[model samples]
Target: VNKEHGAWKCHRCGESGSFPELQRIFGDEPEAAQKEAAARWLVFSNALKVCQDTLLDYPHILKYLRHKRRLDADTIGKYRLGYMDEDFIKQMRAKGYNMNDLREAGLIAEEGNRPTFQGRVIVPYLNRDNIITLRGKKIGGNILQARGVSLGLFGADNVRTHEGDVYICEGEFDTMYLDQLGYPAAGVPGADTFKEEWATWFEGARRIFIVLDADEAGMKGAEKIQGILGNRARIVELPVPEEEDSTDVQEYFIRDGYSLEDFDRLIESYRGTRLFTVEDALVEREELKKAEGLRLGWKDFDHWIHPGILPGQVMVVLAKTGVGKTAWITQVLHNLSEYWIFMDGDHQTQGPGIPILMLSLEQTKAELVERMWRISRLWDPWMTDDHFKLAYRNLRLNDENRIPPEDVRVLIHEFVDDVQMMPKLMVLDYLGYWARSFKGRSRYEQVSDSIMELKALAKEFGVAVIVPHQVSRTGRRGERLELDFARDSGVVEETADFALSLWAPHSKEDRAGGDLGYMERADVRIEILKSRHGGLGRETRMLWAPASLALPAAGERGFKDLIVKEYEWLDRGLLYDDIHKRHRGGGV
Candidate 1:
């Protein structure tokens, strides 16, 4: 072994070892060289010590330090910040570092972008070895300006040397911000990207805390990192306080001036475990099961819709335009209202029976109220006074400015809890109207996620959720009544426990006037194409009363009697021949 090689000092552990001993531990020449290079980059010298000390005193300096020059004592002490002026670059160049090396090291840039990082506070991005590989410049004010190339493993390089859990952030400033609070942390250069190698590097950590920006992109980045680190990572999703556009960790430290205790609480609340097995999902299911009890008011529907939305069930109702899908839901709500009154002995005191949450995206409260009034006039004409009370207290989705899924859930839960009742049913009118977060993904993915989330809410809260979906334009005109015509057929069909499709038959003039002049009648057909707990392909029809927005009672006829009448009409050739023919062809 060479004598010079025998005195090699490990930059990482600060241990001295012979070349032969290094070779035995780290393999041969090339590996040893790489290890030595990595070790050299990992040194925690006085420069790093100064950086850490500065950061501990002035964390707020990080926000403005990115691309601005403004500095204060708080920023200076908390962030361990240093300004990289023209002289610093001159000294670095005189030390034999080339412009190309500086550029590759993310320090300098060409003209147009010519090193605008000047007069800015520099936060170094270090790798796991603690060697500074990148630096982020913070400019104090809001004036838009270019900063130097960002480098570093985020919090990994700085925090890895510590023994406890490590907090990872998106920017060097964020790392410094956490460090000021006396937490070990690091930051990556960009908020959106994470190097795959960092995943393995962080595997040794007992737990990894991720503090990302509070925007959509930041959330996505956190999700990606969580996917990479699996169970070892915990996310800290800090929302920006009011009137702020940026909610980065560094920004939070600067604006809110949080205590370490506050941060600990934030971390504790946001800390989530990775779900790796089916067993981890049971807790949600059990909670849903507990929430599945009815609030006791929808006697009419309970009699019709047997087994009556046992906890964790999802029901989908589909219909063509002007076919009274909303009316059907309104009827169900009315039944629930009656049930509540019966349970409490007074409509005013009755809790929102079964916590009915109506997300009527397509209609305003006025329109829904009008329809409710029509139902009341037709079904329970004596209860006009009570109908107003029912209409007033029930939840409405259109009242909010932003209709996110979380908002929908919160509103539903609040109403249910307020009434001291469980939500028995949730009706989402016209599914296509709700805003979806995953905008760029495939339609299948979007629909699947939406439906699944709705199902999860139902399962979690033990309520029956009914979603109204429009029919797709792809199927044959007559067969459009089939469940397969429902929008995003594959996912909707799979997710729903019960799928009901509604269509109106052609009028007497339609058959005689040929297909072109055929007038649509108020006759309605309901095809139960799929049912998880009951029989399938069952068809029922009723003379739909548009004014009342309901199916007329078949004069003492049962549901089975109505089905028999529809079949008898089809057999007598009184119904539309084309629709009847297609129904026979499709074996409906």
Candidate 2:
């Protein structure tokens, strides 16, 4: 055995090999340790020198770093980024380095006697000035590492020394991108590759942000890391669309046009999983007081809602089958998509319409476009569906394709990230349709889980969600709506910030007069059954014009002749008395 190089020679059998080769041959014998580390250091340094000198010869590798990966020359040279071409083994042999030593250093494969990192970008893990290990990153492929090199964190020494906030990214390129921009960052080989023992590496970090890919695997990894680090780590989610396949930082900042300032703002805005202090609660309360929530463009309805619908709130709308519940909310969505002018003290405050995503399981795209046309034109009796379809060929609404129940939460994140805005509203047509997708589960459990998920999603993205719900048959038949009528579970009423039910005074009379398709006009009353933000049971009336699913606003001229009354505060005592008189002698 040669102690200087950790190499051994058996004269009788004529066998020769390095220490790493021996370790690989006999799996992890900690007792048989290598004392002479200088030999390995010599091989590592020589291999890196050869790889770095030959990097510029590969134009494709340079193009990938400069164009696709958005890396600059300084970044490439600073990190000692290199490329190992197909002839890398030949170059190492030309330098008089032995094949066995190269294989033991992880530059060559022992099986085929070929270069281990053939046609891959070589990234060196450094401890200050000394090289730790070499990682081979195949373009759009899997990662390759040294055979026996046990690396700690990718940039452990850098992170340990960094005094400011540190970002732990999912891959090498993401870390390099942040590092090049003057931010402190480290790389994990993959989503599941972060080790529990590596948590101590961030001891000197002021704050650690786990900015992983916003995918299922990445999220699970983030959860694992949060478990390890406890309150010391905060997960930074990327704004990635569901339709998009990529969710890395490179795609978010380079491809999606997100800037460094945007990234900084996102980091600053995020309030991790920690509980809020009393001071934090007081600050939030004051912020909410000064904020103006989204308005539905209806005079009376907006007044009844007072400050309108705030972000991070879920509002549930309930009605029977043909009570125009969908139509009314469709109008609200349209109103939200247009700019509104309102008086704020002395000067008029005008703001752009809130971007919206309408996820509909009940209506088709064509049907929704038809409703948009109807609301836009105010119940045009002369325009046929075929004619409207032809006239408005380019007409489009902020809508989503039919999404599966499981993908609803993912799609919401995608939509919010794609638009890059907050206070954006998502109108899920109804809650029952989503619950029906979960087979084998009881209706009660399905409904309960669905609403709870929505509440969490609302708070997560800081966006308002409006979900229309169906009332129970008994509740629909009653003279007034109740909170218990929120479909199968009471969770909907309990979780939502506002619970509203739409009612038409003579719905049965209207149905008896003609088929629903032939019905032209109806007087609809919106009953505020439950309000966590304001008073409950406030009533407002609107006139549904001929053939129009939504109610016309008070400013609308066509509905003026219909003489729809204004808002009225409901008197529960008088309402019960009227109901009693109507049901008198028929039933107790």
Candidate 3:
């Protein structure tokens, strides 16, 4: 701690300042301070050649690098790709990189001295020549999940030097894939994060193409980037739900009957940035009124939910198992599809509305059709049993039967051939579907990317995307449900424009004997967790029908509602006044 001019100097990171000032820059936290020092850490990757030679020993890694990711030795050498093992750690330690330094460089675990990304292909995050950070793509087991620098997004420096449309993806492999194809690409650390300042790097670019995961967070993050870039961003929706991530672009490229030209054609079809002018803003306000937003068809939900759902919005329905999450979303989809179909439910009168695409990855199309048919007989007052039977067999149900995903992805090419191409609402049965299509990253990224892609599809088609999800057990443990209970709750809260969390809100004894009385309780415990442009924090109690497995309408109580009779016990207890005071105090 040598002092120069009455100030301490950090010789390692080259900082001259007061102790407090230095501390502010480096921080009191060990990891923070180490990272601060490592920010400007300049060192070339020494393990490159040796790591590449060792790659031959791990034939699996070699095959993954060459065949799976389609990366060559030249690209590997250019990026200075390396491997980190016990020996490599020892060599680094011998070379004077202490555990702190290794941790700072993302070479060792933050909590331990062990090699953080050992037994995996290491991709260095280079700032010009010096490696600033490192990420490890696991060779097997769950190959999609990778360990990256805890802080900082990847691919910022690489894309900054390029010209023309820069493809923004969520994975380093995706960035690598694009660069291998002679395209400029950058990657965020995760779907939820994008270095805000990095948006400025493309100030002179032709356009910014965001090819993030096809899930909620990725799409929301892309929207955020679009806000930053304004009209310079052209968002591309992934054609195959399975291959939605940009990293999967390689697999799509190598697929039969596909090439760079074919891929470019898809890009060309989705090419354009959207911006709003003063006139467009005024027109959009009018459009919102005319459209009246997307609705769940239940009066109470519609009453509390102003303007209902909107185009380019994402709504997640989260509940515990047997809470009727799927049933709720299905009924809402039925309500929405009625406006679409280009014909009425009876198939006699012409109905002119956009189509609804139901992506039921969890449920079969036949099962969904059966559910819709039953709901139609009961939910629609105009339809009789005869009408239900005739229309059920005659009319195409679930829209998937009408326009299957296979046809859109490969079987058919002409979108303008029919208006069926654009849907007003797209209902995905569950979030896990994304992994089935693109399991190229971590589970967090997988879920995030799936929601992001769904969000993108919503905006791309001017539709509202609805996805039903199961809340983590934590959400079910409490008397009051919290948004934090959802699995990947952080991403869910951040990405969804609107979210509804449901719980029974009644005790076991009050459950009313069985499925017949599930909703007979005072409150159904449905809370609106978030709303991008509307009401929030308001809880709505809706009519529940276990027979139809539907939350049909708002309870008749209006503003005045009471908890189930069991709450009388709270009032009858000793220290009731004190308990009431505590409750009132907390509420206040």
Best by TM-score: 2
The candidate 3 region of ten consecutive residues with least summed lDDT is 557-566
Question: Taking the tens digit of each residue's C-alpha lDDT, what string does model 3 give over 20-126?
Answer: 34556665556765555444253225544445555666776767788977888877677776665567677766666666666554455556566666677777666
Q: Pick out the ten consecutive residues of candidate 1 with the lowest summed lDDT.
A: 142-151
Off by over 4 Å in 1: 1-80, 84-120, 125-153, 156-174, 177-301, 304-307, 310-312, 326-446, 456-464, 472-488, 504-588
Writing each residue's lDDT as its tens digit, candidate 1 over 153-270 gives 7556555555568888876656665665677776765565575666766656778888888765676667667756866777676866768765877566656677667777888886
Q: Which residue runs does candidate 2 get wrong by more than 4 Å?
A: 1-117, 121-168, 172-208, 213-277, 337-354, 379-424, 434-446, 460-462, 472-479, 505-521, 553-557, 560-588
**lDDT of each model, Cα atoms only?**
0.55, 0.69, 0.58
Ordering by lDDT: 2, 3, 1
How much lDDT does candidate 3 score? Answer: 0.58
Residue 164: error of model 1 in Å?
A: 11
Question: In angstroms, how far off is 84's CA in candidate 3?
Answer: 2.2
After superposing candidate 3, which stretches have Cα over 4 Å from the reference?
1-36, 39-63, 97-114, 141-150, 213-224, 241-247, 273-588
- Identify the leading candidate in terms of lDDT: 2
